[model samples]
Target: MTPITEVEGRRLALSNLQKVLYPATGFTKGEVLHYYATVADALLPHLRDRALSFLRYPDGPDGQVFFAKNVPPGTPEWVTTARVPRSDGPARMVVVQDLASLVWAANLVTEFHTPQWVVQEPEIADRLVLDLDPGAPATVVECCEVAVWLRERLAADGIEAYPKTSGSKGLHLLAAVRGASSERVTEYAKRLAVEAEEAMPGLVVHRMTRSLRPGKVFVDWSQNAARKTTAAPYTLRARAEPAVSAPVTWDEVARCRSADPLAFLAADIAPRLQDHGDLLAPVLDADRAGSVP
Candidate 1:
């Protein structure tokens, strides 16, 4: 058994990931491993490859473990690592001094890929995301109401929308549409955003400028293209509470307390990967008529 120290934790995490990851269908371990390795190296290079998440340091052809000596004392769970995966080579293993260093580094990984397997493919379907954010004054209760309404409307259109916690403080409603080109996807997204705004009247906004609409839920269309990604389904965001995007049936939207979007953890994610296969498969089918509305 691997010890649960930071170093061991990451290794164990990788091992635990393998258990569910290996069973994921459509894409085999080779594909997933390649993705995992690629994403870890290219996107989340700040994470070390030890007890929590795998971190690889290029030491010419060989690699090195990472450690941190500058981490301050008394850090939280998410802040344990320091060194991220470097884009350049000459990597080596080093100890991360404490938990604080690790967590701080993870925040830099907001730009990584959303793994090709987790989303519905772009060719078969376009995703129109309604990112609902309730400000500090906004309760999760209010968000649930909007979710309930959104679910019914989408179902009536013969569209399937999946709900996930935004890993922050809101809800992300992902509706799968037929795959189209980026322009097509944007157009579809715009139409959907218009419809959603009209349907809700006051609750949802269709603007992308955050500064313009400080406390409003904007219909984010940017997540629809190739190379663009959202946080993977069920990925744990760095938060104290057990905030995760707990998967919910469309009918269950009203039952949740709030849409704080932080209902998932890394542990909760693996099983989903195993059971659902990649959520993107249907999107990849690319039969235009079958995909488009």
Candidate 2:
């Protein structure tokens, strides 16, 4: 067994994560590294004290790697490992079967992907997206500032919200809730977006249309249905240095340009998943209950 350092462990884990990720997403070989790094950084933190593992798809055929959960004797494979399917393709996915297998798993498949569009779970969600160019000439500080404001308001509503770096110059705030229809969810989302824009005036923009929202934050509410799309968690984006849809706390979102939710990696992601684990849970409930009517 290779003695592992923290850095080595992360590398191994990421390599393993790639196997299921590659062919599923059809990511080209060149896009793998950034995708892996982004997901590794965001998800690693939450993986503590758990039996965790990953698979990777490096290049060419036979590039798939797999890991069995690094657990004590007698643990079940099904209990310790899981396969997360990529929304892009039904059969395509990244497998994180266990921990020690990290090193061997990085060899399968190829390509890195960023969502031009992404599909999310079925259900309505109350979402507030702060869209902006993190790499623009403007300061990331300004972007973070807006996130702080959004976080505060959402928190006040007793919403259990999660943040994701948009893999671009923006951030997404996903709130899980119940008892809301799609229409109500969309209305609530618009209300929140409008309110945020009103609160900051020029600091944030809520216009969803590209032509209208040239250089401002647009509170996107479109990710609110069964087939609707949002950036996939940990999926590598199409950028030069790809960014994943990393989870973040309000504090981190409020403070950093890129707050890596490295703590919430796959090993821990399962535990965090609620009954209707996806963000749309609450809104779906509302709609089903006729909240919109």
Candidate 3:
């Protein structure tokens, strides 16, 4: 029988609470739900108004996995969803608005949550993301070096950016921008990547080719496209261990250059939140907005 728990007055039916989701860390399904519940206050703001794409690992990290763009059939009507028009047709995507909606998604073993960069209008974007992907032999430390350099460049342009772990191997830097067409955002990101590559010839590469990645970080500005989605901050990754896509301080990034690559994990997020109180909060602020062009 499925055990039901009431979260802030909303009855949430949970299943497989004892099922192990991360064998390396012995993290269970219940713990995943609990993490979301605990961080819901901080996590929900990022998810609100964004179309969610669920990456589910029903069995565990070692088990079968699949991606679902639309909220699965039988999703409770109480949960809010947005019908966004696609080239094929309009698809309904889940919008995590409150604790109830968050836990409901976690109950489905949703390991990673990804959202569009824009709100409501799927074809527009209000944020610019630069995904720093380090190739083999080039660790996250190298990515951090490149990120700090890029951050300085963006700052010179009057853009305030925030940094966060990719929850796997890379890092993502985001900045709030005036709402613009997706093409405009993508082009702006591309130009920035090109300039970075030119400024630091061998250290940064804007191209996506793997051959050029060794000992260098790839500035993946292409993520700014309308169809592309990056992992939502504070969501758990599907690594052998339960690592989270956590927001970090610029100071932490500088320190990580000489520290562990996977320095942040699911267990580390809450305390950091208590200390820093959502470092990425400014990205959502309308008054803090900047533009790529």
Candidate 4:
């Protein structure tokens, strides 16, 4: 029988604890639970009041994976949700506001993704993001270079940016911005991408056309759109190994040149939190958010 554990007054039946979720690394469901529970303090702030788009891999990362928008069937009553209108119709998405809900979702082996805005302000963006993705022949090392340029460019615009590993390839540069509509941020991000392409030429590509991607870093600026979502920081990705979308320091982003930098795994987050206490913490402060200009 699966054991039932009480977390913050919620009785969660965390099943399949011994089941491996990352076949290559033998990481189990139990480890996933532990990682979320351990990173809760640093992770929850980024997720609270934000509607989630979960990617569930019930059969492990190597097996079938499905996207979950509405709350999973049988979600507990205490779990928070936001009913937002979609192009098709109204949709209810889970808001993993606390430790209990997070663990419950992790129990289902989910990879968390959230939009740039919060539930309270759906169409307005609180953050701007640029996903610096590299095509083959170019690795995250190339992404690091582009991120540094983008960071400086953003800073000149008075927006402070933070870096994180995409947990797959490349880097993500995010900055908290004040009172801008999703369209505004999206357009601003696109302008930056285009500017970077102009500045770097062969080193960067702004458009998503597949043929133009190779040997260049594609500055994906569309994650700022109201409907688009980004992987929540500290969330595990469904990969062959248990890689995480972990935050990094500017120092790490600046000096990262093939020194095998910015790669973080599930087991690496707890210690990182202890040392840095969430490098992205400033990005969570709405009051301190800079203008999108």
Q: In model 2, which regions exceed 4 Å deviation?
A: 1-140, 257-293
The Cα local distance difference test for each model comes to 0.44, 0.43, 0.84, 0.91
Mind giving the per-residue lDDT tens digits that candidate 2 earns over 140-181? 455567666766776677654566566555666655455554
TM-score of 2: 0.48
Tell me each candidate's TM-score. Answer: 0.50, 0.48, 0.95, 0.98
lDDT of 4 by residue, 171-245 (tens): 999899987999999999999999999999989999999899999999999999999999999999999999999
Best-fitting candidate, measured by lDDT?
4
In model 1, which regions exceed 4 Å deviation?
1-112, 115-128, 211-215, 257-290
For model 3, what is the C-alpha lDDT against the true structure? 0.84
Winner by lDDT between candidate 3 and candidate 2: 3
Candidate 1 local lDDT, 171-247, one digit each (tens): 77765555456556656656776777788756666776655444445666555644344554433333443233445
Of candidates 4 and 1, the better by TM-score: 4
Better of 1 and 4 by lDDT: 4
**Which of the two, 1 or 3, has more TM-score?**
3
Consecutive 10-residue window with the lowest summed lDDT within model 1: 54-63
Which candidate order results from sorting by TM-score in descending order?
A: 4, 3, 1, 2
Candidate 1 similarity to native, TM-score: 0.50
